[model samples]
Target chain A: MSDFVQSLRLWFAPGRIKDEGETPDYRFSLANERTFLAWIRTALALVGGGFAVDQFLPDLRWGVRVGLALALLAAGVLCALRAVNHWVRCERAMRRGEDLPVSRFPAVLSLAVAVVALAMVVVVVFGWAGR
Target chain B: MTEVRDPGLQPERTRLAWRRTTLSCTVVAVLAVKVAVHDDITAAGLTGLALSALVWVAFLAVAHRRIRALDAARPHPLSYRGALLAAVCTIALAVCGAAMIW
Candidate 1:
């Protein structure tokens, strides 16, 4: 275990004798990890927002409830998948010394989330007007 | 002594990020439970717990991967476990959130 710690320290710390080819890959990997974390944060926020809806408004209808639930779930799942996919692609690119692939999942998921939110609005409007 | 080749992975930062994410998700799950108390606190709590468990598993997996990858120095530069876990949590949260609204 001590040897493991020493080796890890040697790898991450600057000024260590290392292969020239590996440096760029390391930098990119770190960046990718950071980005992945950011996406996880985003997913957390989305899920939190879903809970917020439930907390703040307790009189919503069945439709609104279903829509919000679906939306939140979709957002979380998509964001998570996208983050991991992005990291894998980035890693692959780094390994091959090529450009990272463009990400479209975020945009698509965002659209879906927005649509669900809009449905919630519609449910509220219709239900309130009827009431 | 033969020079140990660096796989060039950032185990520390990666581990830290996983920890942070797990904590954040757990917090969110707890909040969801809190908000859901009046309507169906039990369901809310259950959902939150489930999400928390998922985050815990993901954290452990990432930590294990980080340790193994760094030790082997195998240049195994691929990570998708975190994102997949996030996806599952998202769906769970959404379902719980929608339940609150109902």
Candidate 2:
């Protein structure tokens, strides 16, 4: 628990980066930040979807509805968590004149989206048929 | 901190990304606010509403500062503080959203 708090502290400590790393072109860091923001938007979208699932699918099996919503909410949390880690790692790599770490998030997130889309499609099909 | 003669448009593009992301966050936050308003305003719901707006403001502020730094030709690596701020805000949003939902 202490370690986790420490890690959180470290993550939040912006000034620690003051003098580290060889200063590269400003564009690199800007691009990295843009990528981080994009992930955050993705997470926010998932949360919005969670609300939509909970609200619109009144006829959905409560179990399935809740499960799907929870999955989406959890995925959003994962994206936020990963966004920081990726940003920091990428920043550190740039500072050290090392290769930026490859991100696997896009693939994972796409798969999650596929799962959600498929679930929604099934739900829609049934809803249309029942109507 | 030497200025690179050819900084290109990447910084501008990145700033644009920040603007888009913050805009999306704000929209979602407003949606959360709508949900809270429709329901009885619980503490969690209100907190989510406030935090959502706060996150957007904070993100814009930091992005602006960083972009300014870029424009000023001080090519510092992106601040870990800014990254952490984004992370904390984004995660707080998720947590507050859960509070509203749950």
Candidate 3:
């Protein structure tokens, strides 16, 4: 449908977010930017790590290695998307003079990383690659 | 009234952050090239290498623009254009990663 296509385009476009209210202090904005950039670095780590694993870990089981690589790539993309949302949220909170919203991402990210590491350990220790 | 507040070297910090981001992108691009070389000279791999190179160049250019804007004496507007560019590049790299993996 035309409507569906339009929405998809909007989703891909960065203009969906509008900075409402007054521009906050440059420091706050800069801090928000730094945070966003930091997350972006995390994203780079994920994507780059994914490619590295895919290239080097021929020893890993096909399904498991492929799945892990895909998971990491997906995670990196999600991080990029989420970084924008977080930056916008912070800016909004600053403009309204409201407390910045608490982000549960750290906890969730930690859990996810742990699970991935465990999966890798299983792959390595069990020698799933050869079988 | 213009919101007059001391930027107090904040812009410099922001510029540094942006540089760091550009640096990170460059590193990722190099890694992608390395991987592509390992994967043999295939179209997809070569495309990934080229795309990554383009992204790193774009990132550097955007960061340079940001720094130039910050140097202006007047209060400058901070646009999300660069951030969007960075995010889109990340997504593209993700696809490239998936492609190489598959």
Candidate 4:
């Protein structure tokens, strides 16, 4: 019906549609959306990780239990922050017609994660050894 | 209106990665609670609830901000402060995860 068509147009109305006469910056928008979705997925994964630790390590003491909780919480917060940061940089690039800013957070965070994980491995191994 | 150059489609990929990370964190938190319950179920329950609440709030806030940025005609790049905060959080979480395993 005409009403349905009108409603659809209103709901899905392309606010920033590129005109044929205009050079569309499709790549930028596409990239931005993709990044947004990626962050969301990461956040979900972190939460899942927390649950996994809690369930499997029932014998863990306060130190382990609390540590796991904190780590997951940190991951969730970090992921969310990164997503926002990515969006801002991408948008700025679009506006200025320049390259997007590079991110160093990933590398730094990765290193931190690796180190912590390593420590955990050590602790678990030693604890088991004693047992 | 001036034509803006869209940054490379990197944000999308980054976003997806973050989502996975968060999901994993959530799982860990739940498991931590389960263990807590056995030792002191009430305390464990409280800790789990607290952690969940904190994470959920943080996630929701970030998601909301990202959506708003997308809608805006001119999106701002992620701030250095925001990035720093994220980095610190990540390191903290990694440490915590390690502690649990150890």
User: What are the candidates' individual DockQ scores?
Assistant: 0.29, 0.56, 0.63, 0.13
How close is chain B to the truth by TM-score, in each candidate? 0.55, 0.75, 0.80, 0.51
Order of models, best TM-score first: 3, 2, 1, 4
Q: TM-score, each model?
A: 0.60, 0.79, 0.83, 0.50
User: What would the per-residue lDDT of candidate 1 be over residues A1-131, giving only the tens digit for each residue?
Assistant: 67335434533442332332343545456667778778877877777766666556667765566557556755765676566556555655565566767756767877877887787788778878998
Best by lDDT: 3
lDDT of 4 by residue, B2-100 (tens): 645334534444444445645544554455445435455465456545654564456545544654554433454443333334434443444444443
What are the clashing pairs of model 1? A69-B94, A73-B91, A77-B87
TM accuracy, model 4: 0.50
Query: Residue-wise lDDT of candidate 3 within B1-102, one digit each (tens)?
Result: 353434477767777877788778887888788877784698887887787778777777877887887764343545767667778888887887687767
Query: Candidate 1, after superposition: displacement of residue B51 in Å?
Result: 6.6
Error of 2 at A10 (Å): 5.9
| Deviation from native of the Cα of residue A54 in model 2, angstroms | 2.9
DockQ of 1: 0.29
TM-scores of chain A, one for each prediction: 0.70, 0.81, 0.81, 0.71
- Return whichever of 2 and 4 wins on TM-score: 2
Model 1: per-residue Cα lDDT over B23-87, one tens digit each: 77667766755755554547555665565556446655655565466444333433344345555
- The docking category that best describes candidate 4 is incorrect
- Candidate 2: regions farther than 4 A off: A1-21, B1-7, B39-44, B67-70
Instruction: Give the per-residue lDDT digits (tens) of candidate 3, residues A15-121.
Output: 54343467676667777878988999898888887877787788776898889989988888888887866766676677778898677887887888889899888
